[model samples]
Target: MTSSPPGLDLDALRKHLDDALPGLVAGPLDAAVIAGGRSNLTYTVTDGATTWVVRRPPLGHVLATAHDMGREHRVMAALRGTAVPVPAMVHLCSDPDVLGAPFYVMEHVDGAVLRDPESLRALGPERVRNLAFRLMDTLAALHAVDPAGVGLSDFGRPDGFNARQVSRWRRQLDGSRSRELPGIDALHERLAATAPELSAASIVHGDFRLDNTVIDTGRGDRVAAVLDWEMSTLGDPLADLGLYVVYLGTPMPAARGSHDPVTTVPGHPATGELISFYAEKSGRDVGGLGWYTAMSAFKLAVILEGVHYRYTQGKTVGAGFDTIGARVQPLVDRGLAALPREKG
Candidate 1:
């Protein structure tokens, strides 16, 4: 029998699955942690004949609303048969006794998620450009999905979504503030003053970036599956676009040692190209993007601060946590810069 990894109880998991899933685990189990996700713990498990991915909240320093397993599972399950690719959901376990927290299992997708500039560059310019086009198109496809048709009509509140996001992230920042963060409040206030009217609401992947997806390199334009849906909800679609642009502009530090630099990678589509493509593909106006991008930067700064908080508490369990806090200020500065110059 393979001994359980830290944070996973293999014996209990096997037993629970045997009882809950029936023949899902036919033999001894082995599991290895999947790094890169700072908010959740992901593991790959195999039982001699089959493989699956498991997602659970981080060991400690829990943010109850941010790392919800059920929300992640439900969105993916609802997205099946849609143009947006997502993993096949297998089972959801809510009993904390089985694994010390609720967790879910899904079919393991086989593809690469290029997170850095080097990895993307190795794919050649033409292929990287195609990947970029596909990335934006996929976001358009996701925005086109009807939540009611997919049984997710209640996934999130769409009314006043943009204003709520600003307030919500400020509350999150307040919870994780350890040191002085200049310009964050000013950025948030400006965002509030110029909150865009909700043109239309759709499913928003709170975090949408290159590394958040799996790609079939051979196909170039195919997105095998979109991963990390813990922050997904029914909300303003441009919020997703703004966050994507923010990620493109702000490359995470190499010292933090996660994935490669996305967007900044040579051959990746320019930010203008992405915005134009999204506008053309989704048929949505791009006029309010500046405000959204500022909001995205503010949101990301708060998120990194939370990660830094976990790192300080010794709750994080991977490389790069020590340097993550350093990335917050630059994001805050960028948010300040991205704020809308003209009144909306």
Candidate 2:
């Protein structure tokens, strides 16, 4: 008898797959949870020889609008032949009865998620430098993709996206405010007052960072796939750039473990270099990057605050979220500081 995993009902899943797509799984399945806390719950399942990954919403108190597996699966499927490297989507199940929530399956791509500076340092400065530039280049490629060409013309409303993002985040913050966060509102107001003119609407990976991507260390250290697309939409491409820049400079919290701050690492190009490189590569003027950067900061602060709220409610799984809230104020401050200079 094959026992179910902590977060998955193996028997039901196997049965569902067998009925949906026969001969996919030969026999029983073994499953284990992948440690990505405070968001979606990921599982690795194997049926003797074949391995696959499954993504679902958190255990309880999920924000329905935020964790849409169908949306993630659709974007990955749409970018199948594009420059953006995404996992091979296998199947999508929307019937909540199957595994208690909607879930999707994809081929498990083997790679490392370089989280902290120490891990990046071990790979040496040369590799880190290459990875950083590659990261920028990848974003450029994504921005350059034609939505209509890729069957994603209606994926999101690009018109007034910046304003919508600002309003959307404000509502999210209000819903998740467990404690007082000084200057958060002021930062939001400032960002709203000076939102930049929207660039061409492109697929924005709401959270694009080094850690969110999987790097294949052996295959010339290239990005294997871009994961976690729950916040993705058709928006100003610079919004993605702004968030990436904030992640580059924000200090990793002690309680909530940090990924290698690749931008700070030696040989890795400075934030300015990245911005310029992206501008040159994409042919998009980035004079208003400072505003976007401030918006990014505000956006991230709201996200972390939500995570902290979930943590307080005992709704979060895994570690790192204990001190996640502690990082919110600093992010708010950083966003405010970025407003005047508007520099990346």
Best by TM-score: 1
Clashes of each: 4, 6
Clash pairs, candidate 1, are 115-260, 116-260, 116-261, 117-261
Query: Compared with the true structure, what per-residue lDDT tens digits does model 1 show for residues 1-344?
Result: 57787788999888999999897888999999877777788899999799999998988877659889999999999998899999999999988888999999999998887766777778888888888999899999999999999999999999999999888898888888889988888888988888887879999999998888999876655899999999999999999999999888766443133344466666887889889999999999988788888999999999999999988988887676787898899999999888746555
Residue 81's C-alpha lDDT in candidate 1?
Answer: 86
> In terms of TM-score, how similar is model 1 to the real structure?
0.95
lDDT of 2: 0.85
Error of 2 at 293 (Å): 0.7
The digit string of per-residue lDDT tens for model 2 on 251-325 reads: 543212344455667778899999999999999989888888889999899888888888888877666777788
For each candidate, give its TM-score against the true structure.
0.95, 0.94
Best model number under lDDT: 1
